[model samples]
Target: MDKTPSSPTAVEVLTNLVADDLKAVNLAIVERMQSPVALIPQLAGHLIAAGGKRLRPMLTLASAQLLNYQGDKHIGLAACVEFIHTATLLHDDVVDESDLRRGQDSANAIWGNKPSVLVGDFLFSRSFELMVQADSLKVMEILSHASSVIAQGEVLQLITANDADTTQEAYLEVIQAKTAQLFAAACHVGGLVAGSTPEEEEALQAYGNNLGIAFQLIDDALDYSAKQAELGKAVGDDFRDGKMTLPVILAVARGDDEEKAFWKRTQEDQEFRDGDLEHALSLLNKHNTLDDTVSRARDYGNQAISVLDIFPDSPAKEALKGIVTFCIERAY
Candidate 1:
């Protein structure tokens, strides 16, 4: 924001810039998550209290400031964005039968799958409630459409999950919808509430969409590249889950017949063995898939930064740009 050579991390910078407003968003989240039914709030609070970067809400808040928005609506809307994200995560853990979230036991693991899923439902409903309370049909439309797209993305990912033949185009579609749409909506809603021009709003959406893509790409690659502590989960969690992320896809494409057979056995047939993860890493490095996947993330990160050219210089604008860097640099 200050054009300094040395700056704190992007989230750190944005956290400070929007500190007061983020506090309000947190308060709103706490208030809305409350329910007379004890388990509803308990399970919901578990995940909310679990450490997350809160990046999506930050995007909403940052985008609002980009347009010099003076209103407080973005705070509530930002919480709505987080609720939608948390709801999806809750449902996703149930679907994936995940054991851990944020390096801790998943809600589904602590509570039964049914409670987890039902609480996710509660959160989703609460998100709509917040959107409606904002009193903007356009905001509701955008978030509702994003919710649909995210659900569709989940379905698409499920269909493509174990199949190695899934194309890059199909995978991108999944990430764009599953991960990026909410990000786009979060940023777009900020601009919309601030009454930014359509062009400016679209730019904010583009920046957020690209940032989300980069974020997901890095996450997928990190499943292979990072350590348990650093990644906040097992290194081969995706591999163990038989999830067909980009690195595996690329490795499968470039691999020889034996490698292909291995991927088919492990990923498709789920016939995983002890050294499977090591073999998978070997193949990924041999094909440079990890580096290439990260390169792809960098491409998207660069696009995200480029679109910020539309916004005039401000601390929020610079912090938004820094977020792109933070996302891409995660691989390193």
Candidate 2:
């Protein structure tokens, strides 16, 4: 978890390897985002252009390429995955009332909530349209299940939002649904599209599921450790928003009666005071919870790497493996 960063990042290498294919995906994205009403594309493109890593779609491409997929169905499928992801972000920002996304004003912050939600729906319908066009029931099944699970994950998170009693297992479940499910679906569809054996498909799904969980664990840690510039959002956004991520949950579990009262006051009650964040950090450090959380992430990272053993050697395979290290290194 504390390893030095790689010289040439996995993202750089992966993007370079898939440059041509990614261009196709990008073209598909731009083409599909069009609307009779200008604002649909305007609003959707704003977030799409925001310079995030586009990690899920990359996984889709890399996984398919590893299996040596020859057709262009994956490109359109990758675009559909991006649409689902972007739509979720739009709805999430509205729900979270977030101001900044990837260091820019959130769509809801600029365009108003109604448009944000509606545009999200538009993107969702567009994703479904693409799903239908792909003409593979397997692909449709995976993405549609992922779509449903993502919504379920959001609801589960809402259920646990401010409850201090939320267990580590429960938190993992929430992330799996809201975040990892898509990652898993994206990779799984790649294998399916390549006509991989069911076991290989399952292995890819496992790789993605574990990677997605580790990815989110880092985000939970970053909410405290990363500076605003590094994270592209204000620190303590989770705390101020009363989200009970792992660090807070760890501190809550290990905190003394007084510390528990402090967390309860700020988190459960949403009554954050000036030094509350500092105190939260102190509690997290005192319990070594932050590093411990990353430690769990590392364990999952190892799982993601080991699952790739089933695949024969290829550049795409190697890059997918690099992704595990890159994900952990990013947390550092």
Candidate 3:
């Protein structure tokens, strides 16, 4: 149940490696973002130019290096992953009706929803163009499948939203689809480009999948634990949006009749007020769901590191392990 800050060893290693590749990735993003489509160029630039952590591209680059890849295609492919991730963010903000992302106004919030949606579509098409240009059928298949999984996960969440009956297993499945699939694909594609042995490719894919799960679990934990200002959004955003995440699922699952009624009213009543938020938080605290969620996040972090045991001891492997630790320990 420990939620204390862990060392940032792994993420730092990955960060250093990816930092070196930023020049190429940034160039690719800048080049692709320029469009003759007028509004597309403007909106796409706004989102891409906003500057993100570039973690998706970093995963791709790190995976290639881990397998000793020497080809130049990794650069373009890495940028492609980032483009896809950014596009998802655009659509996600619209769906969530969210105003802020990464401490900045979301594209949908700044622009009208129609324009934001079209720009997101533009990014999706642009990403595919980049992947096709790389001419790796394997890479195309990986990203295409990841995109479908992400969409399916989003749909699944939409169906389950505000439904108190949502189970922990169902929630985890959605996360795997919505988030971890891309991470797995990025790392797996890196191995494929490097021509790594089948075993090595599988190991990297497993590592990425587990790492993604750990990263998301921690993110869910943070939504409950992080300060609203530091988290760059209102606290209990999930609850506010009628989304049942890990914490609420745990709390409601173990709750008594009264607590269950509270959650049910929030979901089915459609008349819930702000005080409901406080009531839900108190119930979750009373049931210690936050601690349970943190424990699960830690378990996933350990599982992510275990997948890296197949790789030989090297800077890449060490960084991969550190990323697992950093995902759970990151304060933001």
Best by lDDT: 1
What lDDT would candidate 2 get against the real structure? 0.91
Which candidate would rank higher by TM-score, 2 or 3? 2
Tens-place lDDT digits, model 3, residues 59-102: 88988888787888889889889989988988998999998887
- lDDT string for model 1 (154-190, tens) is 9999998888787898899999999999999999999
What lDDT does candidate 2 reach at residue 79?
A: 90
* Cα lDDT listed for each candidate: 0.92, 0.91, 0.83
Which residue runs does candidate 2 get wrong by more than 4 Å? 1-6
RMSD of each: 2.8, 3.1, 3.9
Please give the range of 10 consecutive residues that has the lowest summed lDDT in model 1: 225-234
Clashing pairs in 1: none
What TM-score does candidate 1 get on C-alpha atoms?
Answer: 0.97
Error of 3 at 139 (Å): 1.4
* Candidate 1: stretches off by over 4 Å: 1-7
- Candidate 1 vs candidate 2: the lDDT winner is 1
